[model samples]
Target chain A: MKTRLMVLAISLASFSGVAMGFDFGKLLEDRLNQELNKDKKTQPATTPPPAGSQSAAASPPATKQKVDAGQLGFALFGDYSPEEENRIGKQISGNLLGAVPLVRDDGLQRYVNLVGNWVALQAGRKNTTWHFGVLDTEDINAFAAPGGYIFLTKGLYRRLNNEAELAGVLGHEIAHVTQRHHLKVLKKSSLIGALGQAASSKAQGSDQMVQNLIGNGAEIMARGLDKDAEFEADRVGIVFAARAGYDVWGLPTVLQDMAALPAKDNRTSLLYKTHPHPADRLAALGEAVDGRLDGIQGKELANRFYKIR
Target chain B: MKKFLIPVSAFLLCVSAASAWASPGTVLRNEQLFSQPTSGSRVEANVAKGASVNILSKQGGWLRVTAGRSTGWIRLLSVRAGAGGSGGSGVGDVFGAATTRSDPSRVVAVAGLRGLNDEDLKQAKFNAGELARLEAGTVTTSQAQSFAKQSGLASVNVPGLPEPRPAQPSSSWENN
Candidate 1:
């Protein structure tokens, strides 16, 4: 009797964290007792109710564990809907913001959004709603979520000599979103587990819909994409910036600045870990762009660049 | 004359501010050094793929460099501005300090700041309130277009570069 009471107490404690109704807690205790009774083997396995009205009142989803390719929009081939992609991005971006909030500068945030959205316009992904923010951290890096969510650290922002450079950085991240690089990576790494978790998670009342799809926190951002994906982003990003009427050399210049940094700079630790060496990127970019960009005319806009206060 | 001086002075300020002056750089491939920043200018000298050049100044996509006795402008892409000779093939990294923090300004910028690593991200919580704030700052495409118009940044007709054919030499990055 004491053990059963302890089990009931544990069930109620766990369920209470999600702020479910007390009726649901009682239902869970009944389910717990049913499981304990089945464990003794003397009694036939008694199944818990599919869901008590109290639990059903919480509006849980269907209890299906099967996931087809279409649901994930498997990116290159699978057509994951924009709505699904936006949820993943929101969860990831929200987690990242939790780690490091926005820089608290309205002007900086406004400037970044304007510039990011302008460059994104050239990307031609009309279906995606782009949101850009500058992270408060001084760590020099940038990130892009699956659905048009992008960020650059304040440290990286400070390194920009002009708006062109900022456009270049934003363009690179924008390429990642347009390319669906993260979605592809997520799809490839943990398909079985993620799909199952995603299906199971839907039945819960919490807002972690596809939380299992990406695992904990914003760690996916730190899991760098493949070399070719990165290189492709660099190539595509340069064109994106150029097409937006900014100097073609903007991304290259940013890479040069990063390449020239001393190897020990902790600020670049995440960057180097998550990217090809700036030297390698510059070389690869050179191979693609030997004389192609020669005739292109664009703006540097050095004077109008917003200085971070 | 004063107008020309303005550009030259601004150019010099950029080079100094970059602090890449006299920085050791490795030429990624053989490139011709031009007397001016543009390709149409006179060719001063040709530097080989593995040659080391001293980065003197930068303007747009060009880097004025002194390779051996030849001092001229080279396409910035043709050279990487650091001491990693030929980059990853491991040629001139004898002291191993080639990539050491050499720029004073960069050193200052990097000082006293803790890096954001994988752990901090993995342990982060969801900030729904901040997410709302981020969404609030988004600009519509029309708003962006008008903003671009304010700066005279019209869209242009630039073709995307062709993806390079594979078969790059073994790179250290692949190991990662």
Candidate 2:
């Protein structure tokens, strides 16, 4: 009976990985096997299973199940393939640029990308082809698109006191990508399903679905991620910055600065609508950083930051 | 002898209490510790990289830290806060657990038209050229490393922070 339960647990564990939206079945399988092996090693000798059960455990039933190619593709590639996500991101990015001009300074753009890329390398999805841009708008805003695109408005850029602050902002956006926040939102919005149906049917209306998906994704982006997601991004962002050797206070300090800005400021209107008030963000961040990060002093690099700008 | 021991223990208690100011910080770069938190004050000592100091307090950008027996001020930028700060497993689980909640079936079929208002997001048009430009600006890892080296930013291994507790209902933004 214990062996049966163990087999069941292993089968469910493997299936759960696929069901949880992980696209890499092989990776998941390997991880599950490792976990199982680790558990076996750590099990107490007094509760050791019968010798016959050892062989049965060694070859779990989960690995023997035949995974269909279609099922495998769906399970291994998530709802959208990486290429599909990249294409969608490009289209949305194009549309976004159409609405707001990018700051055309090549040097400044490169500098931002360099800093952003450095911070992004420390993220979980390090291999993602990250791109960073400065939007030409004066609105105090930043954005992240699926497939590793991050943007910071010039207004927000100019206000940052140091590289750590800039890193904090970029890290927040990168956190969005690593967490797939927008992508999950897109998947949940019905637009992807409509596109999938149109594509499968070879209908002429597929183009319309594409446009709708893009539009809806843009609207979601503009409207902003859920408050929970925003808070999660803040925590992840600070971690990334701290991992990359920037002051963890950068995010909290920026929050404080934003909080200090008058509520009526036009520049903050869009940002305010899309995010929790800065005071709330600050309080959340303060709690995270106060005791945890108070020991390690990180570099602000203010002079170098100003020089690049 | 009992009275003497009691006085010694009381003095030690006071010392321990005084030493526990705040979190400890590590020096990121070689910097001067000043007698006063301000730059104009006399130099107390020259602290090198990787020195551990207990942060006593902060005066603007200067941190009051005690490195060894010397208690002085160091520029906030000169030290990295926390010891061996690494983005711990605490955060990984919080982010990993975020599942999509929106139901696709509830989405409105009618697509809206676009304009400048925030509501115009429904009608946004794609600009391929701008995307191409954005993609073109990506920097390679080596380039990023060089950039970091140029800015004197060195990677430090700080332990990841624990998962933040859920926000309290008393937050001021709840009204918004």
Best by TM-score: 1
lDDT tens digits, residue span A1-309, model 2: 334333433343335344332333344445434533443432223222122222222222344232221212222223555655565566567667767768879988988999999999888574479889998777788888888888888878988989999999999999898888877665434322222221121222122333334444256567677776887898889889988889877876676566444444456657777787664564455455544565566788888784434
Residue A56 Cα positional deviation in candidate 1, in Å, after optimal superposition: 33
Worst lDDT run of 10 residues, candidate 1 chain A, spans A58-67
Off by over 4 Å in 1: A1-77, A192-206, B1-20, B88-111, B168-176
DockQ for each model = 0.38, 0.17
Q: Considering chain A alone, report the TM-score of candidate 1 relative to the true chain A.
A: 0.74
**In terms of DockQ, which candidate is strongest?**
1
Per-residue lDDT over A182-229 for candidate 1, one digit per residue giving the tens place of the 0 to 100 score: 876765443322332222222112235355558667888888897788
Give interface RMSD for all predictions: 5.7, 11.6
CA lDDT of every candidate: 0.75, 0.62
Q: Candidate 2 local accuracy as lDDT?
A: 0.62
Instruction: Give the C-alpha miss distance for residue A4 in model 2, angstroms.
Output: 42
| Model 2 TM-score on a 0 to 1 scale | 0.58
Question: Candidate 1 chain B — worst ten consecutive residues by lDDT sum?
Answer: B89-98
Fill in the DockQ of model 2.
0.17
